[model samples]
Target: MQPLPLLSGADPTRALDAIFVNAPLRDYGQRPRTNDYTLPVLGMAYIATYSQRAGFNVAVLDAEAHGLGIVETAELVNAARPRWAAMNLLAPTYEMSARIAAHLAPDIALMVGGHHAKAMPDRILADPRMANLRTLVLGEGELRVAALLEDEQRRRELPGVLWRDPLLGTRAAGIPSGKPNPQMLGPDINALPYVNRAFLPQDPYQAAPTETDRRLARNRGTDLLKNAARTGHREANIVGSRGCPYNCTFCGAAVSANPDLSIRVRSPENIIGELDQLHAEYGVTAFRFVDDLFLGAGRVIDEQMAAFTQNRIGERYVWDATGRINVLNRLSDSELDRLVQNGLREVALGIESGSDRILKAMDKRIDAEMTERVAHRLVKHGIGVKGYFILGFPGESHDDIEATVRHIRNLWALADNSPGDIRASVFEFRPYPGTPIWTTLTDAGHSPDALLAYGDVDLTSDGADETMRQRDEFNFSVDIQFGDVPLARVRSTLATLTREQHQRNQATQGAAA
Candidate 1:
């Protein structure tokens, strides 16, 4: 099916078999874009690929990528008149997704899935607001999507689908349709076909510059923007594996709706073939491996690297991925060197906290010592490190906060106090539904809905005036507080760290000049 113009009056002659869309999760009306780093929603592309291969005509609408607002998105969908429309949703976008479903409902059979649906289907489907939503595909969607498209009669019986079976009885018209969910699908990652990137925009989606971006460009000159521009506006994301092996209590991926805990790795040959196509067709040389744990299984990494070496997959492309510190600690210097030589430019690590106590409580088997060692090694080897830290675990104390500060101070000192290469991104703990810790907190009388509301306040924006935003301004993190750490002290420590990193960026820029 051809892409429909937002204002065009022409409708598709016949309804399509399926339409896949990726919607923005913003609450205050749909903005042009939500995130600074926007990549095409690869999961939606994967679902479209499977549906098309199963002899169904499919149309994918990456509304965010196309810079379309909610109204425009609905118009485009209405023109397509697809039999069923499935949208990939995130936690922040749940309320917005419901609104979109309501707008496109009755005429189109609406199906919703992704993180929010997978994590809290019972609550999501039970709500009267989502009455128009027909099906909720849980877990791995590729297999279930293909099954649903191929056999419409048995769509409810298909695993990984929490669909409204409206034909059950007199009671089936409402909430009863969502009861007794189907079993989740256990899909083989290797068996799935390459993502249908053809469904996405050709030029790639670039985030509209925010006030901070404008300020940085004005103060720091064009160096930041120039480097960003050179990285190109067309980076694609690939998933080599699904699911992380470790059960970190704070993670959504850990306590997934899928019963399977094993990491499923795509074969090296299959991955390389996709890369070859991207490089040849799209002129794309940079890729982001959006895996929960890239090195979750050590052997998979070894095999993938070997294939890259043999097939020269890495020589023409540069990429980054996420990894656990313990997994990185296990790699020998030579093994690490081989990966760097094969275009491993960066890896994001979930360091979470510097306190061993917090790490243990969070079930992050690796300790501070190992984290420091691995981070140091990666930097020394010329690979960039993006460390993620969570400031407020429910049980963390002032001393734990100081320990994290000390660890970050040491990490900054490694680069001679420069933010040019080594960097850290911190987020305050948000108690997402379906996580182990979230379950524990809610079990103890805390309302998940209240916590979620607190989380939605934008801590990163300068204009936010919410109470949480005020607290975040002082602590340089979001609202969630742990133990008895004074927010003022946390603010001071964060300001000092921020100053040190600023100095580093200046020094590095000076040296370059």
Candidate 2:
């Protein structure tokens, strides 16, 4: 079905209960056009589905996917005439989201949530643009949102929710002493309804290939061709789990940063059920797990893999997922083989830095050596590796960055000799609110406004012009120097690496031709 009419005005008699909006990253007209792939907002879909199951009329508006600008987005939302206008906020898209929220009809009671909102509730509440914001949902939103939709009067009594009191200004309801109330931690993962994708546009969303996928296609013929000849290449992002248990200093979603979030995973059966549904209903043959941890550690991975194998999922579809380096390192070779046999295409690893010193500073437990070992093992088992690296951390030195460059080279060499591929996905570090590094920088006298002043990163610029189509493949940094390295040096390093990767891709394509 076509996406629900976005600009069409709603009927006066049938106003929507709630409308979840995924705001655009920036004004497309103000920036160079980028070929960034857009996906349906899964978070919004989840919350909408849950609210719908509770007998509420909910709709989702994806301004980003539809490429709607601030004014157009606001118009579409206003046209819906929702009683509540909910939008997710992120650091980079803060300005855009705020502008959209500001333009929303005053009659609509606004509710904002997400990592950025959770981190800086006071700043959001104080923003002049968000004057209509009635509720600021924090942590996991499904429960709090449903409760508020059911009865706005209970906003003050709901845990993980913040609202303005008539007499007392802003106040948190269920949260006590800055700790998550166990009573409001939402339901079991398996108990949550599958996200309703019908709310999304019917047209197939684009899925950009990874660096490894490009390399493999060049060397071993294009699987894209084969897939197109069969069921066609439809892809969807799936989530088998939620929350991270680790305390990585640079991550806003770190366990310590989000104390209200509890790490939870769905049962193997539940995961397989959704996979089957997507494959049947949407022709989704390719799945990318957007979970912080897809299969988890120890026996959890084994149990999930066994279920996939039993279901013959690998035979029907190929998938990629994120995993911890240390956890994968402990897996036996047979386990690795099983993963490959069960259609594990690539594993995204957060190998933050190559320097042990930098790793320790970022609270990333795995070192360069451990990262290399894990990459080699996964590649040997015919599973590709995507190593995520960060440069220019606060206090990071020139030597530390050089170590990261050398490490990237070593992994590339390892993939050259192995059957599987490897991709170095690197970025310049930018501090995010609520992360450990954010606290450190603030403690050192860095103003939050100044730190956040670096606006939405122009991914198409900054030496990424040639790889704009692959913009979604890697996170873009604001290029602001937060470390010992000069900003010029950081830009040069990032440009050089990006240029080399692009050249390698072109060369592989030429060779294949």
Candidate 3:
């Protein structure tokens, strides 16, 4: 809640082993690069928390939220003089990561991980700009970091760790191998410390309001007035689970990184315990589950729901999470009913496209019928549904785009409860280096790394950024229709949808009153 005293000056006496950073993303025109919608980097936060619990003095810094540029961030790290400095990686921040590593390396043992690093370990570790990078921690970092701290030599020995091969001389005969050893996964997540929310800067963060949020406010599902009072209160994110079983092509999570696609869930007690801490200490009344898939078929779902309802945790707060449509389909009607009755006010469904063909291409597994079924079901049970859609994949056609739009309209039509209760947001597809789509493109002889490095697909632009800019403005707001879809028609459809939803929202609100 208070400004970090460590920022003023690290305790000279304290042996600070590591500093975890959520590196600032490059500005994309009007949109500042940040950890998705102003959210804290819980991954970095967890690593910091676990490092501390492991008897290492660790500090977590969120450069984007703090508005610190690379130079300033590097200065702060240098001042702290930590033995190691690690940053979470995202594809958009690749250049930033390289620059930061270049500045902070040599002096500090630099490490990088997260989606980008996990997805492209060899590429990241091989990049000459990352010459100072001491190692790459793949997959989960909580245990690997602690192990590295306890035994500095383990950096080369640990599985899930890819360090510069020491045997090769500085002048490599060929390329240096940055492969990881076969090591054990970290201890169960239930045993790890809760994310250190209190250490975060007091400045509040909110993601840019989604199209869904704006519509839901109109429908009166979201309380616009109460938001002002809640704005300053800590709005936190916690994960009940890690990994999703589904193999969506665009996803860079377990599918891209872990491969096995094994899902791991924390005990409900552990999750609730963390919530209690946040609520009691920081008054975090609003929260979001950062889990890849928050709901599933069996005991985990039942226990979590039972815990929230029976313990009244849900009564104290309202929260939302992401889940696959099919997984939600697996829940009994009563189970889904229980979640909505409690605090499950919103759910983001990965209904990638309305076109079953496109959905299959994305490997979403669930089809148009299943998506529609789960969506209508959630709305019937009074849960707000946010559908995620994407366009501009490599082979996407005008018909595919129309199909997705049709699906969006169908979802909007199916929710009979209120206007704005059902909403869809469209994003242009960017083939990050490791996603299946990216791999597919790369295998077909297109270099995604080169394109991304050249700022082709990224939001940040230059004169060289022209080709990607031409490909489409590549805006996630879906404000720009990339293809044959008439911009005027698209705009008109959006306007009509908003107007209809507003009318329904007003009618619903009036009837309730």
The candidate maximizing lDDT is: 2
lDDT of each: 0.66, 0.77, 0.66
* TM-scores vs. true structure, each candidate: 0.81, 0.90, 0.79
The per-prediction CA RMSD against the true structure, in angstroms, equals 6.5, 3.7, 6.6
Query: Over the stretch 1-27, how does candidate 3's per-residue lDDT look in tens digits?
Result: 233343422234686788887766653
Question: Cα lDDT for residue 398, model 1?
Answer: 86
User: CA shift at 453, candidate 3, in angstroms?
Assistant: 3.4
Off by over 4 Å in 3: 1-15, 27-37, 166-184, 202-234, 254-257, 260-262, 416-420, 454-513
Candidate 1: stretches off by over 4 Å: 1-3, 6-14, 28-36, 66-69, 165-184, 202-234, 255-257, 417-420, 458-483, 486-513
For candidate 1, lDDT tens digit of each residue in 1-513? 465553121224444877787765443243334343446677777778777777777777766555566666776777677788788867655665666776784768777788778787777777676676777776667766776666655554665567654565121211224453322355677777777766765333343332222322333344533344334324577888877777788778873434544567888888888888877777666677878856656787898899888986545666778887888899999998888667676788999889999999999998999888888887776666878887768788989988998898788667553222466655566666668887888887777676555333332333223222213212322354545765445444454555555555556555544
Superposition-based RMSD of candidate 3 using all C-alpha atoms, in angstroms: 6.6
lDDT of 2 at 207: 52
lDDT at residue 240 of model 3 (Cα atoms): 87
